[model samples]
Target chain A: MLPVFDVVLAAAILVSAALALWVRDRIAAVSGFLVTGLLVSLSWLRLGAPDVALAEAAIGAGLTGALLLRSAHRIPCAPSKALPPSLWCAAGALAIAISGAIVWTVTSFGAAPVYPSLVADNLPESGAQNPVTAVLLNFRAWDTLLEIAVLFVALTVVIMVAPARPRTAPLGPLVQPFARVLLPLTVLIGGHLLWQGGHAPGGAFQAGAVLAGGAIALGLSGVIGSKLTRQNGLALLAIAGLAIFALAALAAEVLTGALLGYPAGEAKTWIIAIESALTLSIAATLFLLFFGPAERH
Target chain B: MSELSLLVLLPFLAATLTVAVPGRAASLGLVATAANALLVVSLCREIIARGAVEQVIGGWAAPLGITFVGDGLAAVMLAMTAIVSLAITAQAMSTPGRAGFWPLWMATLGALNGLFLSGDLFNLYVAFEILGLAAVGLTALAGTPMALRAAFDYLTAGLAGSLLILLGIALSYSVTGRVDLETVVVLTESSNGRIALALIAAGLAVKAALFPLHFWMPAAHSSAVPVASALLSALVVKGALYLALRLSIEGGAGAEFLRSALAVLGTGGMLWGAWNALRAERLKLLVAHSTVAQIGLIALAIGVAGDPLQNGLWTAAALLMLSHALAKAAMFLAVGRIAEALGHDRISGLNREELRPGAAEFAFAIAAISLVGLPPTAGFIGKWILIEGLVDEGAVHWIALLLLGTALSAAYLSRVVSRCLRGGPHVSATAQRLPWRSGDVAALGLATGALLLGLAAALPLTLLEVPFA
Candidate 1:
């Protein structure tokens, strides 16, 4: 029964991915993308990677789908030019060859769990019960720090480009009431995610996205102001993650003897502090990316 | 702080600070770049005295956490980056940029530092991501319709390149269970490993704007502001090319096939870029195209010096990169000053007597001489070493191609040089006074450095003796 479900879900995923690529209408293509995202998240769930499944569902499926839908509304859908038959045939063949090589390589990988056992061994001192969180926030915090910097750079680029300001028009009276209820719930869940990150699947990214979702809701309903403009404070908030993370990493180096090293046994406290700041910074940056430079009233 | 970490962190912190406080961004940029240059100088000194400097981030060792390694090659490249960045930063200071430019430039500096120092494949990918986005943003800062469109193409190309690199990393991890640079030897033992490496090489080639994969480079680099173009043409592209060289050296057996292929592609890029540059009407476009030609030359050097054990040949390649970075950066900054005074960069219009060519023209002449590999410049020394190596190996065909590339560089550069010196009819009664700004001084300083580097060839040669890996 489990195998059957897996096969069906995989098939659905493939179909939706193809649909996303081949669909002519923008709306339909986006719907296809959303479906594929959901199915992919479901596949993650079936693989027993609940953390990945949650991320895929929240950020990958939900936020990405929303962004796509919004973009689709702005751009007119046109029929994409079909490639020449010879080109298509060549591409197909190349894809097959590459896929075959990949499959062969994966199957022949030696019977070791690779980094997992090593990660487990070092997990205790890494300050988080959850290995993934430990890796992200402590062990390999440099990558995470740079990752947020990537986000911050993207935000900076978008602000520099200054695209058309997004409308803050309410979705009518219905959205106000809906947002009023949803906003509080989002904050609670987001905070919970941040706190739970030490021992579970939740972390700064997931929590930040949830908070951004709430901000987006308020933005859509004409509450908390609309049309994200470049405010000095907002800009500060946006870069807060990079600033705080760098300072923390440097301070750690000074206090301890190594870059990004935590003080003995007090790792959890530092990680949480960094995460909370990152949560706010990420939320602001992503929210601003979704919203254009705030409209001057 | 460990010098290795400071190499990446200092610029990153400065970039954030620049973003936070944009009021004195240009000045702050100058100060930061100066400090960063000093740091790089110290790093190079340390690498020369010692062997290499390695630091583990977050107290986690390799295969679990990233490491920063600064070796002879990394030191040379960092020094090159430092020189170019400082010159460009000084030029930018004289002519203030848009509010967004300083931070993006600083971020790019940080990213380049990270790229050169990163000892792990995945960490390099993150660095590439930051580098790519910041570079694209810088390209679009010109704010022209053409600039924006080109930036979009660059963004797409960069993303595709990064995806290929990421795919290669994934494959590598699955096979060797390590994304560290040290795993390259183990990676060469299998066909899958070879393919993975090829993918990585291809991705880096795209980012470096090697021929055929470089459709977005000319327009993007040519259309950007002068300071931005100087950085983009000189330092940003080298970041990727540096990676390609590192991979070939570390990749052991797997690199043999790729090296020959790179040589073929590189030779093609050399001639093709020269052809385009010779035909380019706009001065900036000509400079940008010349970059493609120069990159081809460096890539050819890397391809030829595929074996790390061939110390002299490999060191020659590093020297070539060093020479190109300095000369090309000086050329771009000179072009920027010219464009500013003339109010246009049309190559044909460069002869106007009303807009008399001053110190900027002198700088352009010197940079052009270096680019053409004339005597008493770093370019000549580098090319001479490369040709000598080719002679020893009896690779006469490559020798001929290298000479032909030199002649073509001379020919194309002379087009701009002669035009700058030509006398044109005084069209406007109101003489557009080409006041000497500090930007010209920066250009002259860089050009002088390139010339001095040729005379001081022993310095870099000594630094390059420390074997990579």
Candidate 2:
């Protein structure tokens, strides 16, 4: 049963990915891409990486699809041009070479480490029960800090370009009921994910993406769309995660000589506090991006 | 917090603050920049006293934790970055550019600092992402349609590079179950590890704009506002080159293939970039192209360094990078002032008879001297060490290539210097020096720093002798 499911899943992912590139219609292309992301996330789950799977589904598929859909109509599709025969041949050759090299390298590795040693041994003092959470918020929290900075950079760029306020037409009456039902469910699920992250697969990124999804849904129904411009409050919300993380890093360093090191047993408290702030910031950033361009005031 | 961490965090905090209060972005940016400069000074003194220092985040040792290493190499980069940022920030203060410039630039500084100090492979990728996105934002800050389109291309290229780097990290992890600097030594033991290094090198080449992969760079660098151009051309590209250098130092004998490939690509980029600059019609494009050529020269230096763990030749590459950052930023700022005064940046229009050589013109001339590796300048000291090393290695062919590249650089940069020397025909005997604006002063100050750095080259050379622990 597992073997059969894997084959079908792999085939579906390839088909959707091909369609994502081949489709001429923007909406269809984005949908195809989103489907591919979802399938890939399922594959990650099959590989026993539920944390990665959750992130891939939420941010990689859901948020990216919404972003593309928002900009679909504004960006006029260019006429497709076929490449010359020689160029096509070159591209094909290059592709084959790269694939061959990668396969050779992968096969030589024998087996993936899955989770390298030392991680499990050091887990007890990591402040989080879940290995993924421990790695992200403790062991290599510096990478997470830089990752937060990366998100803010994206937000700042979007604002710099200040794409038009995007006259997104309010959705039909059916959307109102959908949002009413989804919004409350979103808050519950997001809160649950944030709280469960210390010992489970749910975390700030997934929770934030889920919350952003609800916000986008409500905005589409004209519930709070126009009011959520790139105002001061929204800007504060967007930057809060990175600012909080950086300040926490400094505070941690002051308390302990090592950056991001919590005092012995207080790791969970710091992780939860930081993740809570990150969820709000991440949600705000995704929501702002979906609404299209922080219009220049 | 360790100075290494503070070097990164302070700018980040300022970036967040700047975004929060756009009206006070300039003052906040300057203050943060000054503090960052002081931090670099502190870090450098520590590195000089202590061979190299390592900070393990959260007190988690490597293989699981992220570490920041402040060796002589990282110190040199931090110091150059700090000094150059000071001038760039002062210029940005007076320029009053796009509202996002201050915040974007602050993030960029933090990212560069992080990129230089990161000892973990995955953390380097994260730093690269932050630097890449922030750079693209700076390029798009010009707000022109062309700038926006260029920024889109840059974003595409940068994301591709990041993906390649991530793939490399994943592959390396799969092979060795590790992603710290120590993995560089372990990666050399197996073919799969070699492939991982190649993949990472390929990504860095794209980010560094080495020769064939530099398609997105010229347009993006040439079209941005002056301060943005200075930061992008002088510093952002260095993040990738610095990583390549770090790999060579850590990988040692096992990474010969990557080093040689870098040298070959560096040679190609040097000539290709020079050839393009000689042909470029705009001043900014010429300066931007010069950056590509200079980066190639540094890459070539890295290629010939032969196991940096045993020899100090790679310090030549580091010196070249330091000299290039200062000189290139000065050139861009001076170019900005000249363009402002002339109302256009056309190379042909630079020799305005109505104007005599001003402070900006003099600054450009000094910067050009440094670029061409002339005497009494930082660039000359770098080239000196580079050539001396090449001679000792008895690589006659490499020496010829170096000379040719040097000549090519001089020929192209002279295109602007000659124009700046506009004299005889134009009746401007009574013309006073053009009033120095904030931009001109910044340019001249940076140019002089580069010029005087040659005399102080011993300091960085000694610092480079400090071994990484």
Candidate 3:
């Protein structure tokens, strides 16, 4: 019964992915993409990777879908031109070939499955009970450090481009009450996720996405985006995560002789400190990216 | 503090500070570049003294944790990056660019350091992500419709290349249950491993702008500000080429198929880029195309150098990269100065009777000489090593290809050098000397460095002897 449900879900994913490519309307294509992300996250859950699933749903689907929806509104709502039949055929062929190659390769992999057992054995000293958290915050903190830099670079690029101020309409009367509820709910969820990261499937990214969703909604409602321009402290908040993370990593090395090496019993403290800063930074960055950095001065 | 980690992370911290305090950006950028140069020099010394230095991040052992390795190749690249970055920073200081340039440049520097030092494939991918985005921002800093279009195309191409790299890493991880560079040998044991490498090579080829996939590079390079162009053409693309080199060295005999294919593509890019460069109307465009050809030459060297562990001939590729970065950066900076003085960049407009060729033009000629493999320049020495190696291996056809590439380079570069040499008939009696600027000094210094590196080639050669950690 579960296998049948998985197959159906996979088929649904393929259908929605194809729809995203073929849809004529910008909103429709984005909606299709969002559906695909959602279904893929569900597949991850079935595979027992709730951490990946949470990230895929929140950041990959939720935040990205919001960003795309904003872009769709700004862009002219026109039907996309159809590609030539030959071009379509060529694309289909290439896609099929790539999928076939991936399938063939995955089936033949003689994977030694090294990391899971290794993470398990070392989880005690890592200061995080969750193996995923242990790996992300302690075992391989360097990659996470670089990953934050990647996010920061993306934010920098978006700020560098200095997009034209987005024109937003006034919100309806119902939005105030809606936002009042959403604002608190988002804060609650974000705090819960940040606190739960060390022991559960929630983390900085998912929490940030939830917070950004609220921020973006507020932005679209003409409530506060105007005041939070690039000149505001939002930029400082955005830089805080990377700045703190890099300093901590360097300080760890100075204190312990190993890059990103935490204190013997204080790894959880370090990880939580980093993630709390990251949650705020990521939220500010995503909010800034979705809304314009400046809104007509 | 470990210099290797500092070299990568300090730039990032500086970039953040620059963003936070925009008024102090220039000071922050200068300090960061100085610190970066010092770290690179110190790291090179450490690598020489210790035979290679490795730092285990988070104190987690390999196959679980990432490591930063300062090997012979990494040390030289870092040194080369330091040299170019300092010069570019000098130019940037002299010419105040858009508000965003400093932060973007600092981020790019950090990304390049991370790239060269990273030993984990996944970690390398993350570095590429930052590098690619920062470079795209640098390109878009020109704030023109053309620059924006070029930046978008560059971003698309970079993302496509990155996708291929990530896919290859994923497959390799599945094959070996590890993402460390050493697991490459295990991945190559099966057809799946070979395919993964092929995918990675293909992706890196795009990033390196290796032939057939190099279409997005020239426009992107030519459309940016001068320092940005120099950064993109001379340094940014080298990240991909560096990874390709690492893979070839690690893969060894197993990478033969990919190497041969790279050689064939490099041969094509050699002719193709030269052909396009000869017909280029603008000076910057010509230099950009020449980069494509020069990358082909370096790729050819990597292709022909069979086992670096045995023969160490791949050092020729490193030398070529070193020379090209210096020569190409010098050419771009010099072109920027010439364009500034003349008010235009058209090759036909180079012989302005009112203003005789000055330091900038002279710098361009010397850079072209190095690029054309003339004696007493690093380019010539690099080619000499590559040619002598081929001869030792009895690979005469490879020798023929190098000579052909050499002649083509001289032909296209002479198009500008000959124009710059116009003096007796073309110059007016009242021709004025160009005013001194920091750009001229930077260009001349880098050009002279390329020229003298021929005599000093042994310095880098000695550095390149340090083994991988």
Candidate 4:
């Protein structure tokens, strides 16, 4: 019965993904993508990775969908051109064959994972209750640092290339009032999610995405202007995480006699400090990506 | 602190300051690049004295995480990057028409640094993305219709390359269950894991503009401003090639098939690029096409298997890259001055009566000599080592092809050089005397560096043999 439920959710996700690709209307396609993300998140839940499920819901469904929708509104729709039946059939056949091969391979060769016990053994020293967060923030912090740099670079490129300001009208009156009421509540919830991430299925990324959502809503409501301008304050805010994380690691070498080794018994505090900085930076970065460069004073 | 971390951070810090400084763009650019060059010099000193520096960034342990291991190859490349960037910055400062050149250039510098020092596969991807975007931004900075079109084409190609690389990363991660370089090395020893490695190497080769994958490069590099062109041709393409070399060395047998494929494509690129360069009408276009040939030669050197004799080839390839960086930047700068004086860069139009021989023409001659692989020049030293290495390997066919490519290079470069030398028909004319002195000095300095560097090979080679890896 449980397997059937998992299959149903996976089927729904596949169907939604197909619809997202097949739809002619850009707005509808974005919505379809959102549905696909949600279904995928549910599938992750079924697989017993609730932490990933939360990340998928927040990042995949919520933030990515929002970005797609915002960008879609800016893009002029192309005239719909139907693909030839032959091409469509060929694509469908290819997809089916590939997926079938993958399924066959996985089912036949699947073995019990070897690293779970290793992760479990080292989990306590990582200063995080959640194994995935421990892996991401402690054991593999270098990847996360570089990932943050990637986001920063992407933001820079978008600012350099994209038009500074949209020519469209500001958010309508109806959306403005609602945004004001919801912004604080959203921030509160985002903070909770971030706070709970060490022990639960929420982390800095999910919290940051939620926070970016609030900021984007504010921008859309015209509370924040759409002018592509450089805000030095915001840029500094965005860089704080990287600076703090890098410095902390460097400082550890002097204090602890090993690089990236936290001072004895202070691991939790260091992790919290890094996560807090990252949360703000990640939120600011996502907001900048959506808003483009803020108008320079 | 390891030299690798400093090498990566210096440009990044410079970029941040460049953006933070509130001033005329040229002044900011000058300060940032000068500071960056100074940092590079200091790093070179460290590398020469102590060897290559390795650091696990954020103090993460390898296999489970990321690390940065700099060896002799990385130090030499970093120094080359610094020299080219400094020369290009001087050229940009002299030419004041560009508005947003400095920021984009700084970003490019930062991206190059990131690419050079990164030891992890995923970090390299991030570096690629950063470099790709910055290069595209620089391409579009010219703001001409042709430049915009070229930039868009470049952007399309770059995005496709990046997507393929990302997909490769994802697949590799799924297979190995880790994204770090050391962990991937362990996992890739198995035959089944070779497929993922091949995919990644293929993706990187496309980004590096290997032969058939180089269609977008010439157009993008040729259409940009001279300073921009110098940077793009001399530095940007090298970033991806550097990453490919790093992976090949680290990946061992898993990458053998991919490396051989690169060698074949590189050989084809060398032949095709030289053929086109020999016939190119525009001087800048000729230089741009020549970059394809040069990069191909470097890739070929890297593709050769590691052996006692082959190690010299690696050093020779490094020297080749350094020489090309200096010679190419000089060529571009000299041509920019020529175009300014003559009002156009059409190679056939140099016979007009009003054109007078000046410092620019002299600079062009010196740069051309280096490009043609003349004696005592850096290009000659590089080619000589390569030829000797090939002879040791009994690769007579490749040696023949290399000589042929050199002859073709000489043929094209001499065409431009001779035209600049010839006295055109005299006319009663008052064309403004070319502001050739400063630009000429910059070009001369670089060309001199190219020549002198060959004689001082021990310095860079010592830097390249750093024990960080």
The candidates' DockQ values read 0.68, 0.70, 0.81, 0.31
Encode model 3's per-residue lDDT on B4-32: one tens digit a residue. Answer: 88899999999999988888898899999
CA shift of A128, model 3, Å: 1.1
Task: Name the better of 1 and 4 by lDDT.
Answer: 1
Query: What TM-score goes with each of the models?
Result: 0.97, 0.97, 0.97, 0.88
Considering only N, C-alpha and C atoms within 3 Å, which residue pairs clash in candidate 1?
A228-A293, A228-A294, A229-A293, A229-A294
Model 4 error, position B308 (Å): 7.8
lDDT of 2 at B51: 83
lDDT of 4 by residue, B223-266 (tens): 98888888888888888788777776666555666667777887
Root mean square deviation (Cα) for candidate 3? 2.0
Label model 2 with its docking quality class: medium
DockQ: which candidate is best? 3
- What are the root-mean-square deviations of the candidates from the true structure over C-alphas? 1.9, 2.1, 2.0, 3.9
| Isolated chain A TM-score, each model | 0.94, 0.95, 0.93, 0.90
Model 2 lDDT per residue over B116-185, tens place: 8889999999999999999999899888998999999999999999899998988898788778888888
- The candidate, 1 or 2, that scores higher on DockQ is 2
